[model samples]
Target: MTNPLKTQVLIKIDTITYKGHSVIRINIPPQKEISFVGEKAFIREDSSTVEAKGPKLLAVSQLFQK
Candidate 1:
């Protein structure tokens, strides 16, 4: 049997308290379906959101075909 689909994202955000080594990690599993905003796809890098362009845009477009 196949696992149920989960399109919701799970982000892990850590709160810093004591001063020491801090780490930020995000786990984005492989996408089963692509989502768009205003007819464009955007990727999140750290704390920035940038539009996908060139080959990236092409790849995203292909997802619709699948």
Candidate 2:
């Protein structure tokens, strides 16, 4: 029998890290450029509003680089 895969998700905002089964990682670039990860990515005018908008899902090396 084969074991199931264990998924790990992490969300880092400033110096705080939120751990869960699903996460959204947002990277804010200098100037007006904004980047994000996961589904339902919403880039608001404020950089503090980015978050996971849907149900939990597995993510491996999922990143949004600007």
Candidate 3:
């Protein structure tokens, strides 16, 4: 399953039996900083994540340019 944080993080999960008891083990790798979405960029404003538009979009592009 993917991480709930929406980083598209990959996870490894397994089930094991120990002493007649079942246990679940989850392994989560590190996550990297998220650049804007591939198709469209987004910015957070006032506790909200909104699509970058107009000036905001340009600013985002400039800030994140490789």
Candidate 4:
């Protein structure tokens, strides 16, 4: 069996890790209004999670690129 999301979980002797390597596609109609809460709209850039707003939101939507 395999995960449709192409996600992987590994359990070490003392630690657990999860990894995902896949492209996720979402369809949002043009001019659609979308709202995201503070907790939900975060962009992971390098080692930090940044609040997604203005240009940052566009940056975050790129998906799996950050």
Candidate 5:
């Protein structure tokens, strides 16, 4: 069964020289369970991406709350 919280993202960019525009779509599935596996969450800090863990992971998970 599909998750009710599944989400998607739509992006559009206009081109110059009368080439019209470009569009893209992204599909984001809801996290069913917390499994690190080969996946590591990162957050942007200044000009770099820092690994997220501990409290940081909790904070990120809270963003998806209904």
Candidate 6:
């Protein structure tokens, strides 16, 4: 059987902790799906590829938000 559909997204923040953690706050909308794979993260929207980025996923997400 096919897996349930899920849309994922990674948000970009402008700050980070010294521990190398992302400080960017994100507000994911309902019905969207998101997942993080190591430094890279992936997001899907309505069964379509939305985004994929490295540790700096937020930075990339910001670009698309604009």
Residue-by-residue lDDT tens digits, candidate 2, 1-66: 011111112222334345744544544323322224423444344566444444321121133222
lDDT of 5 by residue, 1-66 (tens): 222332222222233443565544345444644434357766557999688799988887777564
Better of 5 and 6 by lDDT: 5
Task: Give a tens-digit lDDT track for model 1, residues 1-66.
Answer: 123222333333444545686655554556666656557778766899888988887887787788
lDDT computed for candidate 2: 0.32
Stretches > 4 Å off in candidate 3: 1-8, 11-38
TM-scores, in order shown? 0.40, 0.19, 0.39, 0.32, 0.40, 0.22
| Model 1 per-residue lDDT at 49 | 86
lDDT of 4: 0.45
lDDT (Cα, tens digit) per residue for candidate 4, span 1-66:
123212222221132343754444433323223234534565458999667777777655654344
Candidate 6 regions exceeding 4 Å error are 1-35, 54-66
Ranking by lDDT: 3, 1, 5, 6, 4, 2
On a 0 to 100 scale, what is the lDDT of residue 25 in model 1? 50
What's the true lDDT of residue 35 in model 1? 58
Let me know the TM-score candidate 2 reaches against the reference structure. 0.19
| Candidate 4 ranges with C-alpha deviation above 4 Å | 1-35, 38-40, 62-66
**Candidate 6 residue-wise lDDT, 1-66, digit = tens:** 013322322442245565777576644544333444444565655788655656456665565564
For all candidates in order, the CA lDDT equals 0.61, 0.32, 0.62, 0.45, 0.54, 0.49
Between prediction 5 and prediction 6, the one with superior TM-score is: 5
Query: Model 3: how large is the Cα RMSD against the reference?
Result: 9.1
Candidate 3 lands at a TM-score of 0.39
Model 5 spans > 4 angstroms off: 1-37
Worst 10 residues of 2 by lDDT: 1-10
List, in order, the clash count of every candidate structure.
Answer: 0, 0, 0, 0, 0, 6
**Model 3: lDDT to the true structure:** 0.62
